[model samples]
Target chain A: MPGDAWSRWRAFAFFAVLLVAIAVLFAGASALYRVPPAAVVHDVHLRVEGPGWTIEYRADTTPNSTAYAILAEAADRLGFVLDARRYVAPLDSVLVESINGTRNGEDGLWWLYWVDGAYGDVGADRKALHDGSDVLWAFREYPPREASP
Target chain B: MNVRSFSLRPHKRGKVPPWKLALLLIAAGVLGRLVLWEMPNVEPVMAVALIAGMLLGGYYVILVPVAVMVGTDVLTYALGWSGAYSPVQILGLGAFVYSGFVLAAAIGQAYRPRLLFRTRTIAVMARISIPATILFDLWTAFGDWLAISRHPPMNWSLGQVLEMQVPFTLVHLASSLIFVPIFGTLFLYLHTHGWPMAGPSPSGTDDSGPE
Candidate 1:
């Protein structure tokens, strides 16, 4: 009975140690790898290229504003609808489904974004912008052999 | 403490038929996965797989989880759900994903003797779920890196992929911690009670009940 008790306690202790170690590792990695929040960016340029139409705007954005945030702001000012949906799996971020009534999968085209000439690797809500950032939302077919955003 | 104690043979005949129990588990696993499809890295399949190993034992351990994953995967692709992969990506990614569940089942099989329906056993199950989840996440993350993340457009380095994986892994850990014990207790109860009377054992009859 004593040996049994000892083994159980040992198991519990080992579990506790593992938990603590994981916590420490998570904290360390997060600190080391997490993208630091961007400072407030004045004159963040945003462009939306919809089917046969284009809209451009500039705005001073708060700190940590993502590409989606800027697009939503421009849409509000310009009076065009910015339709988006949040997807949680694969990653937690918003997908821009449509802009100004141009829905995704229409004519085999989807709304994709590029920031500073780089294709957005993450969802628009996760593609954080910095000072003088150039954000572009284009409704177009995916590039050859390219995965959908 | 003996080798025989860990042996998976001699599975007793419960009132419930092994096939029915297997179906119930597969359905639960598949449904849970579909319902939580949007919430990446959070699902009950792993927990159910582990429980399937413990309750059903033998080949059902592998059969149950495989059925759940393959069934849901087909549905996801057919329905055009998010994270639907191309045929090539499916083969590459599925190897890791399916194996993760199989590994969880293997863990459950190993821990079958300790599942005594006691408080200590519950704690033990909960504790083991952590590593099971971590292993699953790590393996699948590597798979993602190999099949998807390393490709063009993103072309993320392995370190970058791992860095991004931390949050998903944390959520997975949370999911496993919550589901493993709940399912473990539920199925253990069902096994003991032998619900849905009158069905054949998966293996040939062994009349001697669980040790």
Candidate 2:
């Protein structure tokens, strides 16, 4: 008894439908997502300097990109460690702990990021980028006497 | 002594002559597990075990996944991957993970009477696979937490452990959802075509299915 051999083809057909459903679901998800466009090249001066070493590079940052994104791109090309983490609320961006083997809290020394000669209030991961902006990351003491914009 | 015996005994029941098919399926399952070992939460062991249970019997539902895992784990160890776990931890994880396969097999046995390549069967398989996958992941994650929490570096609460593991289990769920239907249907079709079905003998005179 073939037991209705025609019924068995239902498996393949069912799998086909399943695959199509999955494809459609994924396609729908991707359509709903806001995919960022390709970055437009804007020459931004990036300087990551410490007491012992200074690494300078020029990067093409996209409009409204984060400083951390630019630094991450630079770090990958430059072969340096950019150890950062984003904690829970009130700290939802990358907090730089170390760069290029230089760590924060070594005798109270820390990595402070300055963009366009102004102290960035937000974390590096949140700082908006602009064309021709000079980004500086320095390992220095905090609580400077003069207010840095 | 009304020792009501089943015609489909492991040693008996040479009706369809399924040894070759069974061996091939077991070997294929082991090979699949080995080749796909690197993929997290994605493997055919559960689906294979379910098929084994549904077709072979409840006895094999327990045996198939264990055999697949142990066989592949041994080969994996020989190839220097060994899962990097201690013997005790391996044993513990295997027990929990195997339980999921057992549950799947049990479901197969329970549903064997009407297990066919139809819409209802597919829906049941999907439902069963989700819980089976969750059970396997939870059991394995418990094993992981047990192994990790003992180490000095880990001071995580159980809630935190589960929280951290939500993504992995979710992936496992998706994997099960995908693989269960694919393999289950394939095996079901094969079993229908006389590919050695084994399982607990259907009561009241072996209504298991066609030979």
Q: What is the Cα-based lDDT of residue B91 in candidate 2?
A: 71
- Give the per-residue lDDT digits (tens) of candidate 1, residues B25-45: 888888989998877667999
Docking quality tier of model 2: incorrect
User: Which clashing pairs does model 1 show?
Assistant: none
| Number of the top lDDT candidate | 1
User: Which run of 10 residues does model 2 chain B get worst, by summed lDDT?
Assistant: B1-10
lDDT of 2 by residue, B1-211 (tens): 0112223343222223444545655786788777765555557777777666556763565667677777887788777544334566567666767776776666655555444446556656666666666777677777667765424334446676676566556555656667677776565555444433554332222335531
TM-score of each: 0.75, 0.54
Give the poorly placed runs of model 1, Cα more than 4 Å off: A1-39, A49-55, A60-64, A87-92, A105-110, A139-149, B1-15, B196-211
TM-scores of chain A in all candidate models: 0.70, 0.66
In candidate 2, position A111 carries an lDDT of 77
lDDT per model vs. reference:
0.72, 0.62
